[model samples]
Target: MATFIALVSALLVSSVYSAKALSSNYYDHTCPQAESMVSRTVKKAMLSDKTVPAALLRMHFHDCFIRVTPFCLAFLLGCDASVLLNSTSKNQAEKDGPPNISLHAFYVIDIAKEEIEASCPGVVSCADILAFAARDAVSLSGGPTWDVPKGRLDGRISKANDTLQLPFPTFNISQLQQSFAQRGLSLDDLVALSEFAASLQSVCPMHNKVKNAGANMDTTPVAFDNGYFELLLQGKSLFSSDQALLTNPKTKALVSKYACSQEEFEKAFVKAMIRMSSITGGEEIRRHCRVVR
Candidate 1:
C-alpha cells in the first residue's frame, strides 16, 4: 500500500511540473520584446479597422474551443497555425470548417508574426502570439487586459472534422454548460465567456434575413463592459443562447452578480482567459504562424 501511494504521489507532482512549462514570463529570456511587438501590431490593425477587436477576440475563442473541448492533445490543433492552414487535396484544415468561416483577424496575427520573426527569429510560438494579440485586441477596444502565459509550441496537424466540437450559435444554456465542461471549464467560466459572446454579437451581427440574430447584445456594443449581464437581466440579449443563461437558476445568479460589479467580471474574465490559453499543453515555438516548421 505504501509503495502504491508513493507512485501515485510522484505521478501527481510530475504532472504539475509539466504544466508549469508555460509561464507569464516565458519570453523574458528568449525574446524580451515579443509582447510589446505584438501589442504594437495589434493596435495598428485595430486603428485601421474598428472591427478588428471583435474579430481578434472571436479568433482566440475559436482557437481554444476547437482543440480544447473534444480531442485537444489527441489532434494537436490548439491555437496553432493548424486553424490557419489552407485546404489541400489531401488535407482539410480547420480554416475551411463551418464554425470558422466567420472568423476574422488572421491578417493581424500574420503581421505580428512577420514582425516577430524579423526581430526574434524562432524564439516564440504562434500560440503565444495568438494569446498576446487577443489580449492586446481587448485592451485596445476598451476591454480588461491580462497577462498571457507563453512557451506554447505550434501544432503540426489540422483537420476540418476536428473543429466539429465547437459550440454552435444556437446552443442553449444546458448545451453551453456541457460544451464548456468538456474543456474543463465550470458554470462560472461559461458566464464569463458569455460576456465575450455578447461583445462579438455587435461586430458580427447577422444579416436581416437571420431575424433577431442581428440585434446588438448590449447597450455598449463596442466596449468590453458588463453590459452583457445587464442585457441578460433585462432579457434583451441578441441570441437565444445568451438569453438561456437567465433561464438557469445558478447562471442567473452569476449574471446578476456580474451585472452589478464590473471588477468581479474582469477578474473572472482574466482567469478564464488564462485557463483557455493553457489548453494547448507543452508545444514547440514555431517560426511561422501558418505552416508548422
Candidate 2:
C-alpha cells in the first residue's frame, strides 16, 4: 500500500509541476467557433440523455488524471487525450482500463471533434475539446461557468495498466489526502471536487442491480447545486471517500460552509475545476480523438 501511494504521488506531483501554460483564446484565430461547437454538441446530446453532463465531466476528470509517464513527461504530456484512444489487440488503451470502464459520453467528444475538424481542420486539440465540453456540461446544468484555458496537445501513448494508478472509490481519508496533495491540491479543492461524487451517485446508486437504477445524490441533482453538501451533512453520501470528508475538521467545515451557501460551493467548485483541468501535457493534436495522428 505504501509503495502504491508513493508511485501515485510521484506521478501526480511530476504531472502538475511539468504542466504547460494554456490560454482561453487559444483558438481565437484558428477556430473561433470551437467552444460554441462543443457547447452545442454537449447541449444537443443532453437533450436526449440527462446523463451527458455528468459523463462528460467524469470523462474530463479521468482524462486529466493519468499522465503519459517518464518518457512523455520529458515532452510535457500530462492530461492528454490518451483516455480517448481505443484498445488494440497488442495493447489496451486507458479507456479500456479497469478504472475507466464506467466512463461514458466519449461519443460526445467524438461528435464535437468531428464538428471542429470540419470547420477548423487540425487546429484545435482533442484535449481542449474535452475541456470545453466539461465546462459546457457544468454551465448547461446550471452550474458556474468559466473560460477554459485551451491549447493542450493529444498524447500518443496510452496504457491500460497506467489507469490503475488513479484513486479508488474506497480510498480512506489519509490516502485521499495524499492523492490530492501530490497533485498540489488542498483540502478545500478536495471538498469542492467531491461534488463530482454527488453527480455520479445520482446516475448510479450503490449496490443497485436494476438497469438504470438512478438515485439522487441530492434533492436537485439536475440543477448542479450545493444540495450534495447539504446531503453530506445528513450522512447521505454513498461513497466512503465522500463520507470521509466529514472525518477531518477542515474538510468537514468546508462541507458545512458549502451546504449553507450554494454560492460558496459554486465558487470553490469552479476554481478547483480550472486548477485541476489546467494540469496539461500532450504531443500533437490528434486528427481523430480515438486515434493518434
Candidate 3:
C-alpha cells in the first residue's frame, strides 16, 4: 500500500515537471518575447509557489462580482497593493472597463502558482505558470482551450499586444468569433463561453446598464454557473455583447439551449471547459504569439 502511494506521488510530481518543461519550451519557442507587467505578475505569483492560479482566479472572480477589493487582496496578500502601488483608487478608475483582468488575467497566475507550488517549489518555471494560467483562465471564464502550441521562451522585450487582444465587453459576435477561431476555437466553445457572464459586476449602478446593466445576471453572479443565460432570456442584458447572444440566431440558439434550462448549460459548459482547460499552452511561436519582451 505504501509503495502504491509512493508511486502515485511520483507520477503526480512527474506530471507537474512535464507540464513545466513543455510550457517553458512553449514560452521559449513561441512566446519568447513574453515580457510585460502581466507576465511579470504571473512570474511573481508563481514565484510565491503557494496560491493556485485557479484559486486566484476564483478570488478575482469573487471580488469583482462582489465589488470588494478587500476580497481580492485577501487571497493575493500584498500583491494587489503592489499592483495598485500608492493609488487605491486606481482600481476604481480601471473598474469601469471590461472585467477582463479581475476575471481572467488576474486569477490565471494565482492558480498556476498554486499548482506549481504543490510540486517543484521555486523550480517551476514562470513561463509555464503563465501558460497554464492562461489556458485555465479561458476555461474558467467560459472560453475554449483549443490547441495551444507549446515551447514558448521568455524574450527580453514586452508590449501591449498580448494584453490588448483580449475581448472587449462591447465587441460584436462576428468579431469575437473571428478572434476565437483565430485561436483555434469553435462556435460551440463560443456559445458556452457566455458562462463568463457570471463574472459580471454591478459597479456604480450604470456599469452593467446594457438594456438594464445594473441588474445581476444571476442570483449568484459570483458562482460559475448558468445565471447569465437566463438574464439574456429576460432581455436584461448588461452588455450589448451579451444581448446579441439571444438576438443572434447563430449563437442565440445555444444561449436559448442553456437559458431554457441551466442544467443543459451547466452540463455543456462544464464539459466544454474541461476539454478547453486540458489544452497545453505556449506550443506555437508565431509572430503574434509572444509579447515584445
For all candidates in order, the CA lDDT equals 0.72, 0.79, 0.40
TM-score of 2: 0.87
Candidate with maximal TM-score: 2
Off by over 4 Å in 3: 1-158, 199-224, 274-293
Candidate 2 regions exceeding 4 Å error are 1-19, 68-76, 203-221
Best lDDT among the predictions, by candidate number: 2
Ranking by lDDT: 2, 1, 3
Ranking by TM-score: 2, 1, 3
Expressed as tens digits, the lDDT of each residue in 62-90 for candidate 2 is 88777634334453345688889998888
Better of 2 and 3 by TM-score: 2
* Model 3 lDDT on a 0 to 1 scale: 0.40
TM-score of 3: 0.45
Candidate 1 C-alpha lDDT tens digits along 1-293: 53343345334433433554677777888889999999988776655566666777777877776654342235424555566556778988888888888776698888988888998898887878888988887776677888787777777777788778888768887777777666556678888878976765665452211222323422333466898889789888878888888888999999999999999998888888777666664356676676656
Identify the superior model by TM-score, candidate 1 or candidate 3.
1
Model 2, residue 203: what's the lDDT? 53
Question: Model 1: how large is the Cα RMSD against the reference?
Answer: 6.7
Deviation in Å, model 3, residue 39 alpha carbon? 21
After the best TM-score superposition of candidate 3, give how far the Cα of residue 229 lies from its true spot, in angstroms.
0.8
